[model samples]
Target: MGVHYVEGDLTPEAAAKVERLGYTAVWIAGTREPRLTIVERVLAATGALAVATGIVNIWYAEAQAVADTYHRLEAAYPGRFLLGIGAGHRELGTDFRSPYQALVDYLDVLDESGVPKQRRVLAALGPRVLKLAAERSAGAHPFLVTPEYTRRARELVGPDALLAVRLEVVHCGVEAASPNRAPARRH
Candidate 1:
């Protein structure tokens, strides 16, 4: 699990520090900008820290561009950069399509661009998407989900697909009192 945020830009030095501080991975939230640039910078900074896209909205970026980045990063950093793409929220555009179809199309583009299924992951939660993750990509990288969700997702996705779920850790009463209720409400 990792904490993801949208800092405007992160320097290579800062990215290296993040790795040295013991974070297994550094996740960046993707907007409309060239997110691959960020991945490249972070990968150049760290020797071993993994860089993951929290959710690369398929509606926002071209699949060819995403695929190019995936290959570039894999060539430069090997197993250190993982692409996590998703079918964005429905109300965003006229292209607001069915999640399954959108994902399939996005993957088709990725495949056309030569990005291997083993190197990317889907931002999946529900059963249908999880099955797609099993068949199409490396696995599911579900966000803000519960233990029960993980248990059920495992069953739906089968044992082969990787399940990288996000979980919040609370250490004290004061910590637990914060907007923790909001995250819990989503589940």
Candidate 2:
């Protein structure tokens, strides 16, 4: 299983701890620009643990730069790094016009730059984008979604593409109050 941890200034020591804890992968969420150096350090610290960008903002990170970093990391680590790229939200001051087109163009650039479809994922939520992700990249990384939404997404993406959903766990003190509470109580 992969741990979706926002590695904001995460130390190499902590990354090693994650590996020791038996998590197969670590998903690091970035805002504008992804910390490629940090990712490299984390890979260096751990053995056999995959490190993925929960998402690298397409609006801020240059496609060529991202592609170069991907190639370097792949050479250094080999099948240990996954690049998740996304067009950030409009509320975050990013231009939302033609976002789909922008993402397609970005993916095209990555393709030309030698970052293959299997090495990357798209942060997609809507139907159109999800379709694009399935067609162009390895899979879809949908954050803050319900199980029902996931079921539908799976149907849309078909059986071949990977569906990496980010589930949020809210602590409500009482298990009865939480929607996703387990049937069997833990001691």
**Which predicted model would earn the best TM-score?**
2
Worst 10 residues of 1 by lDDT: 1-10
lDDT by residue (92-144, candidate 2, tens digit) is 55566688998999999999998999989999999999999999999999987
Q: What TM value does model 2 have?
A: 0.86
Residues 1-187 of candidate 1: C-alpha lDDT, one tens digit per residue: 4546553666677778877888888777654443478778878878988888877888777788778778878888988888888986645566856778989999998888888888888999889999999899989988878899999999988898888887655544667577767665565
lDDT measured at residue 66 in model 1 versus the true structure, 0 to 100:
78
Question: What TM-score would you give candidate 1 relative to the actual structure?
Answer: 0.83
Q: Each model's TM-score?
A: 0.83, 0.86
The deviation in Å at residue 59 for candidate 2 is 0.5
Q: Candidate 2: which stretches are off by over 4 Å? A: 90-97, 170-187
RMSD of candidate 2 to the truth, in angstroms, is 4.5
- Candidate 1: the clashing residue pairs are none
Over the full model, what C-alpha lDDT does candidate 2 score relative to the true structure? Answer: 0.86
**Which residue ranges in model 1 land beyond 4 Å of their true spot?**
1-3, 7-11, 90-92, 173-187
Alpha-carbon error at 24 in model 2, in Å?
Answer: 0.2
lDDT (Cα atoms) of all candidates against the true structure: 0.79, 0.86
